[model samples]
Target: MSHAFLKIYNNKRNKNFFYKKQIIYIKNIIQLLIIICIMHNFWMEWNNFKKNKNISISHIIINGKKHYSNDEYIKKTISKILTTNNFFKLNLTIIKQHIKLIPWIQKIKIHKYWPNILKIYLTEYEPYAKWNENSFINKNGDIFILPKIYLEKTVNLTFFGPLNSQLKILTMYHTMQNELKKYNFFIYSIRMSRRESWQLILTNTIELKIGTKDIKKRLNRFIKIYPILKKKNKKHIKYIDLRYTNGVAVG
Candidate 1:
């Protein structure tokens, strides 16, 4: 081969080798960066796992302890169905449902304090009056099963109505009760009939048949003339029928 041609060939071969080395170096650098990125992500995940591993339910506090519910029972129930034994991993929705099943529990709020504590705030139903033998009406007019211990005690303003009629009956009872209290008249049992008529019996066993129509008006009329009627014939009347428009029919 000629020296000039050989020299040119050698130079081209060296150039090709240099270009190959540069490509390999760049590939190695890219692989190292990828490895570093992978290691960084793995380390972050490992650190998170280590932190979560130590999280657990260390403390539980329940507020509003009265009447039917207490802390131990609530904690016991929450422990049973809690998705994770760890307080940090507990599902609030599931715990809320379990807690709300406690009788008379009206409203509840749950909060998770980080690192191992949980707080439960509970609000129970407010009992307005007694319904039937073993149930009570809340101030919101919702009926709840009364604890048996309360059934024996005399409940003020005894009420009876269709299950759906609780709100209506309760409202009517309150209105009449306040008005009647002025005349020293007290209701023994107020019942709403199937026909939607209302009749209330007094503590003295005298029934006031204030039918469906003009019920409030009839009650007011009875209250207005109660003193005169009681004086004239306290024991003479069997039942006072306020269904009459012109005058109260005495039965």
Candidate 2:
């Protein structure tokens, strides 16, 4: 009976040892998996860092311009700037805002190419007309002042009033010019009335009072009578009133 008890105790001890060994092996495997995962993450992070560090600027491109600026000048100007972080993130809106903030740069687009290239495109404001010498207006009627360099050379039409007023007057003047081409009459200047009516100063020194509404009909009627008046050698007519529907009054 004593020998049998000793044999059973030994068998129980061996079983406990084997169970402990199994637990240790599993723990080791789990540790190894965690280490491998950490190493993989580190490797990925290192590769990304290297790629970012290798980024470079390949070409400095510029577009949408006239005789205003070139790529080399723009590149030089931008290179002098100390903001590289903003370039990498490459927010289009932010880039546009920054470019427009510059006096000569009206609108712009800055683009980034991965693995080290950047491109820049720009839209320069072409001043077409001058409004009272203080501000110059572009083709779209956007008002801006001229740079010191361009102030001397920009031959712009003389205009008056606020931006909205000037734009309206310009549009009307251009329309009238286009329509009156057949009559060989060109408008020198156009003034807007307080009630939004229009008064035109013709190239022949004739003043015309065009009412606020029905301008097309009024202009057509005036064109019909213009040749007759010119044939009668009437050069000093003060004002032609085309506001009336049935008749035109000329002074």
- TM-score between candidate 1 and the true structure: 0.68
Give residue 200's lDDT in candidate 2 (0 to 100).
Answer: 76
| Residues 51-129, model 1: lDDT tens digits | 8865776688888756667678888888865546675557888889988887778888998887677888888877777
Stretches > 4 Å off in candidate 2: 1-59, 70-93, 102-107, 114-117, 126-141, 144-159, 203-207, 211-214, 228-251
Per-residue CA lDDT of model 2 for 165-217, tens digit only, reads 87787787788878887788877556776578877777777888888998878
> How does each model score on lDDT?
0.81, 0.71
Q: Could you tell me how far off, in angstroms, the CA of residue 48 lies in candidate 2 after the best superposition?
A: 12
CA error at residue 85 for candidate 1, angstroms:
2.8
Query: TM-scores of the models, in the given order?
Result: 0.68, 0.53
Candidate 2 Cα lDDT to native: 0.71
